[model samples]
Target: MSMENAIFLQKNVGFCNALKRICIEGFEYSTLYKRIEKMIADEEKKEEKNEKLLVDLWECNLLLSYQLDSKMLSICVPCLLKFALKKEEDEETPKEVEMALLSLSNIKFYRAEKELYLNEIKEIIRNHQEHHNLTRLAYQSAWQFLMNRSLVYRDLKGIVMNELHFAREVGKELEEFAKCVDWKKEKEEEMGKETKEKLVLMRWFHVLFIFFGLCNLWNEEFIGLVGGIAWVLRAAKENHKKISEKYIYLLGNAAKRRDVKVEGLLKIGVVDSVLEEIQQSTLNEGVTFQSCHFFLKISERLKEKTDNDELEEGNRKATKMEIFEKLEEEGYDDTITSYHEFLHLLKVNKIDFDAISLDISEYFVNV
Candidate 1:
């Protein structure tokens, strides 16, 4: 047989052998584990056939199967992490590294012991951003690994927020995503598949940020960042209903934060975007509620900022007046009426409609 045919036959034989082993009555998972360990360790000596064998295992679901025992996951995770973190002289990311990241992503089960490798994965995320060696898919895989773990491991949430500095990193990424797609051009003209994909990624980032924000990971520092509330609101100008609704929801959540700087909201024409959402002909009840609440909360925040003596009196007065004017221009009374209507429809007892009206009127009083 020719060399190419010989290698193909050998690969098929190995796959068949693995399947046979899995079906055997006395098969021990440890046997499969040891085989994988050996293959990974002797990859160079085996002329890289081991990488192909690993890929076959993954494709056969032998490695990627979530039904596998938790013990098996614990074993595979460390092995995969070590392989992914291996140093190499090549400038390009090796296929081995990509495969390892892919496999790690599939191994979804997490344990306290896995916390040891969290820092290592964080390194991969950072290095990939700095060096551009890992493909985008691989880099995203690394993030998936962390996000999955963070969900199951509560301790990792704070680590991901404070240690990873996700606010800054996610902000930078969203900014880069914005640059890749001309939202104005897409709205006015036609978009290619790649641009569409970028928009999808943009939504994914927004969703991810919202998730973290609800987890109490976001803070005041986010206002001025590249991917902050203002940056997200910019998408509201486009007629993408899903994006508009989601960003408005996020804005409402941010408005509730006492620490968040209300000036950031007025400076970015946030009221205009909120008005655009409120006036959507097809706006849903949920979005309408959020938009009205956003106005109420911003007014409250402006009052808080004005009351605080830390800010310069002139700047505070100017900002508070500017926001009140925008609110009046955008029909704040009409929004409050809508909010009360929603309260009645939803039977929401947590909010005091009268108090909300009073708080909003406080802003207009000072103005």
Candidate 2:
């Protein structure tokens, strides 16, 4: 069937219902699986030129990815990875590489046990990192794969941290972009025009790094994770609002982690940034929402920290009073009071916390 027909059926009857009718009522998995298998076999034949057929097979795999179960998805992984890892010869386009990576990322989501293929996926990611420019799609896909893995599999924390370090290195250009006196003005300059283009590419890289860091918020003990947060805070202080929002969301996730130390974040000026954003009268709604969210979490964390005997007596009292004084001095107390009213309005309108995250989709794209 054509893409148009498939889309029409999906829109009219719904995706899952259309899929069920096509797969269950029309063509069964056994038959479709055989057809996919034959297509893969033909693609592997040295004597044949079956690129079009292979592209069609990948498109089907992408569609199946929407609802395939673990077993069915597992059956398709090898073929998908084979296509994903294939050398880009004269005829290959970047879209093919992107599709393959997207399919692998999708299939990896449903598999119950990820251990069996984690190393292979890591290797693919490393390959992309080494040849970064040639494999932008692969690089993005690989980071996304690691992000998903980190969220679902706790044991992969060490690996995820290491990859985040790699991501920071990959995103060094963002550091340069951060240093620009004004990115908006820079974009109008001749030399800065090229930097602007690269900045667009770096957007996803920044989002992925922040997301990966968010997933590891529970592992605050890791020195790399702590250092990463500090780096993000520094960047947040200097970068444009577009980039700063990502850093704010990262801080919010870290603050919300029950195991994280409030003092450590306080020492790094996370509290100051949140307060600064909250105090800005011209702040946009998305930034204001994240600022409010981070403020609420910090308050909760501070209260919990104060109640516990983890800190030395003198230090605890001083730190707690300092934070409270800062809030009152900056009028954050009134902001919180107004935030409560805002949140009550949200509740009355049936807006949930998850919906708030979706409202700020630019910062938290895939999360």
Candidate 3:
């Protein structure tokens, strides 16, 4: 079917349900795979002149992706990889590239030739990380593959480092947002132009989400990047709630890591930022839960470090008392008060701390 006809069917009978029904009612994988192969062969014969056929095939690939299992879909991995790899030698359509990546992203269960396909996927990510229109989809696919395969942390270090570098570079736009002294004026400006600004804001949030994924690796290089964690803290203090929630998630992950030294987080004021979010009455429950969990983690880590006698006196002070003193030096005395008050409120209300801890932890588990 053409894209238009498929969209019409989707509109009439919800896309996923329609696809499921098709899958149930004798949609033969081998036959469909042969049809797609024929289409690809035809397109290649014309030297990529048939954009319409390629698009229809892309739509078919997308439809196939919703199903959890398909042998032919597994076999089609090389063909999808071919589309992705073509970007290196010749310019490809942005839609085709995105569809190819999205198709790869949807293949959650891998059955065929894991190492060969994984190396190809990694090459796609490395070569196209700089693509103007395709980077986000590329990263999304990489995240999917990494999560599904249970790949080692080392497998993703390069991608994580690349994303952090991108975050730091694109993060410069956030400085203007950080410098806005009047929250009311900033809110007004944001609301007035929200339609145009929404895409840009979402792009930034995607970058932060990628950072949240990296925190699972628990790499010291990510934590120790000069302005990496600081940029996230600054974002948490800004006006956007979605962006702030992502920052909270990144902070929560950083605090949860058992291997890395978290002093960089403290020096960058992650504690103060989490406290600020918790004290806010207007934030969502998800944000509040993450902030409280982050607070608890930091407090626990501090206690653990304080009890360790192997550390020198100055190191102890830097990790414990002096960090809070740094908060005071930055004039966050009220923030500290609010932090204490929120903890007291949690205790008094008998809020299940265990329940709150899973909100962020569960998200990372699936990712």
Listed in order, each prediction's TM-score against the native is 0.62, 0.59, 0.60
Q: What digit string (tens of lDDT, one per residue) describes model 1 on residues 16-50?
A: 43222223222224564455445544653565456
Question: How do the residues 197-265 of candidate 3 rate in per-residue lDDT, one tens digit apiece?
Answer: 333344344445545555444344454432444454455454666656766766776676765456766
Candidate of highest lDDT: 1
lDDT of 2 by residue, 1-367 (tens): 9744643443334223222223233232556545665665667575866655654565454445345556655545555565666666555655566656654544334534665567667767666556653344355555655565556666676665556454354444334434433544554564423343333333444445545455444333333344444444455442345445656776677777766666666775668756665454355555666677887777666555344454554555666678888877765676665665667788798878565643332222111
The candidate 1 region of ten consecutive residues with least summed lDDT is 358-367
Candidate 1 vs 3: which has more lDDT: 1
Model 1 vs. true fold: TM: 0.62
Residue 62 CA displacement from its true place in model 1, Å: 10
Q: Over 4 Å off in model 3, which ranges? A: 1-65, 88-92, 129-133, 151-220, 224-233, 236-238, 275-281, 305-309, 312-314, 326-367
Worst 10 residues of 2 by lDDT: 358-367
What lDDT does each candidate get?
0.56, 0.54, 0.52
Models ranked on lDDT: 1, 2, 3
Clash count, candidate 3? 0
Per-model clash counts, in order, read 0, 0, 0
- Give the distance in Å from residue 59's predicted Cα in candidate 1 to where it truly belongs: 6.9
lDDT of 3 at 245: 70
Maximum-TM-score candidate: 1
